[model samples]
Target: MGRLHSLRPAMTSTDLIVPDPVFRRVPAAFGLRWWMAGWRSFMQAPLPWLGLAVALLVLLWLLAELPMGGLLSQWLSLPLLAFGVIFAALLRKRAEQARAMTPQGMPVEPQNEGTLSSTTQRWTGRIGPLLLVSLLVLALGGVIGAVIVMGLGAMFGLGLASFGAFAKVMTPGVGMAAGLGALAGSLMTLLLLVLLALYLFSVAFWFVNTLVALGGVSPWNAVKLSVRAGFTNLAPITLFTVLLLPISIVAMLPFGLGLLVLFPVLSGASFASYHDVFGDEAAA
Candidate 1:
């Protein structure tokens, strides 16, 4: 009787305490709902889109200059980059303004308006200096990262070549078997590259999440939390990414014109994803 009673309670406890399903990372996604919300929000205040457009155009123009070089190219690219900064500052101001005018019709906080306006002024006041500073910093970081990745790739290639030679000697009887093995090894290497890409993307997303979560604490703290939550909820992130893949391919079909809509939606959804995970703490 005692054994049966103990087993009944154990069964009841097991029934009561359900284990969380590993695959259910994302809250029930309503892609249409998220897309509609993102569209409405972006359309209501398109300054952020405008800013991104300006940045993209400037980047394209600069890249074009490389092929169509000369004094004119240099003159044009330099000025466009400068103007892109002004547009960014303006866009930031408009974004702040839009945030203040929330749909709730709740009384907009006076302090919020004041702080936003102050930030706007500061951004506009020293746009040139800040842009130059940012450009130099980004260039340096890009160069260093590129060098490191290139070095790693060279080392990997050298190792693969050595392996190919060893495989040829060890399996001489199996004609072309060594070559097939090398090809398979190359495929495995490619898979590793893809994994690395995902890791880098995860890191980048965490960084952006931290940047967007400005205030309340240091960016480092935000980064730590973002990375932790992202890994914890990888299932949803993976699902969303898979869903986006087809959309991205379609967007690229029309010479990237669809990107204007697709890009903003993705950006807003990223913000939404963060909001879903961290709630108001991230919203701030």
Candidate 2:
């Protein structure tokens, strides 16, 4: 514990701006480090963490219930998630500090630093950066979505044209074969586009908000650094994403009750990965 605590850099004060955050490279297996750190963070204060997760889930659900709520929720999700990530970062720091303070003979105790209300109030000052990051994420995603839609639409049109040509061939068997081929081509095209969209959006959006909220990075700087960091750490991020698939499914299995635990775990994992890649130099 002492060894781990020692490696952490001193926490930056919230009031100071960190315009340029230093990035570090981590190993491919660092995905496991993220999950383990996340899990340990959850174990440290399971109850409060779970409670906060539940409250977050409930708040989102309620937001989604309002008129035009689906769109509103989508817009707000990133900003809100940044808020949660900030709180998780705080919890992580507090725990590490507590560990550092305990003597060799004493057990490290769980430190519950603040109520959710207090934490929320404390970080409201950073809402501008959080919301700015959120807006940029949505805008980039929107443009990507628009481009992909146009491309897919054109691809579908081509498939339909080929299918129509196949139908006019006058020979039943030939037409059927051609039609099937066209359909297959369309499906493959759709699959490829879907994957491309996911990859592009992931690179654009993954760590932008975290950089802004915790690192005090300006919005534009955060966006660039976030993408650079993504490419720089691609192997680790891919491994981390692959690991998420099964766990995410399992978390969804039980009326989503597992999300109370899983959400915070993922949050911790985000903060952990940030700490590893960006170091522990956070703005508060």
Candidate 3:
């Protein structure tokens, strides 16, 4: 197994503001390639990768069993989960760099690896900002959802009132207006919910975690760049989603235990996708 090591320079206290990142237009099939790369990375150090995934799952499960723990878990898990995956990717990257630097066919000695204390400190430093960004994103989603609900309610009210007026002319007290209004309201509510979900998902598709963890971008800037990059390469993003759907389902089976393997693969895939989109020049 490869030893864990700090692949990049230590993060600074000063926040870094990266420029708008450029993205490459990859073929739709690259989605599969990303998954393959992730799987390979996981295989290289299965024990550590799987151990991390299992630990996360156990923590989440325990949290979920407590009263109100589900809510607490939801909020806390985002950064913790992100930290593990991104950290693993960082270690994998460092290993790759070390290999590349070695002379051709020369024996590479075991070197100093990143300690747990350093990893925890680095991740803890970033988690606060990442959590804040997540909260802001949630707030945005709530606002969008509220607006859609209100607009739909207003439309339903107006439509019903107009229909009632017309019906009164034909026959007073038929009383079908209320029923029709309720039905329309329900349908509109469902539609609005769907729209809100799609909007939030679009926001997440951008590589925000990678921007923050690897690129050293401030949270807000990472969000902006991620969203921009996602939209700029919408086709590839769509293809990746479509390709991932079935794989995700399969990973959820086996009593959800498959995640031990799948999670690291996903982490690796995320790193690959980020690298593909923003090449070496984009690193902050």
Clashes of each: 0, 0, 0
lDDT for each residue of candidate 3 in 1-284, tens digit (9 for 90 to 100) = 23333334435667463365676666767777787878876766677777788888889889999999976786677676666656555656565666867998996532326633455666776776768766655666578768877877787677667776766675444546554666677678768767656854664545877776666666788778777777766666666677777878998889977888888887777777777777765442
Would you list the C-alpha lDDT of every candidate in the order shown? 0.47, 0.76, 0.68
What is the lDDT for 150 in model 1?
89
Q: For residues 181-259, what per-residue lDDT tens digits would candidate 2 score against the true structure?
A: 7799789979987986797678555678778767767777888989898888887888888899899999989998988
Q: Please, what is the TM-score per model? A: 0.52, 0.87, 0.73
For model 1, residues 182-272, the per-residue Cα lDDT tens digits are 6677768766775666555453343232222221223344344445666766656665666777988997899977776665555555544
Note each model's CA RMSD in angstroms. 15.3, 3.6, 5.5
C-alpha lDDT of candidate 3 relative to the true structure = 0.68
Ranking by lDDT: 2, 3, 1
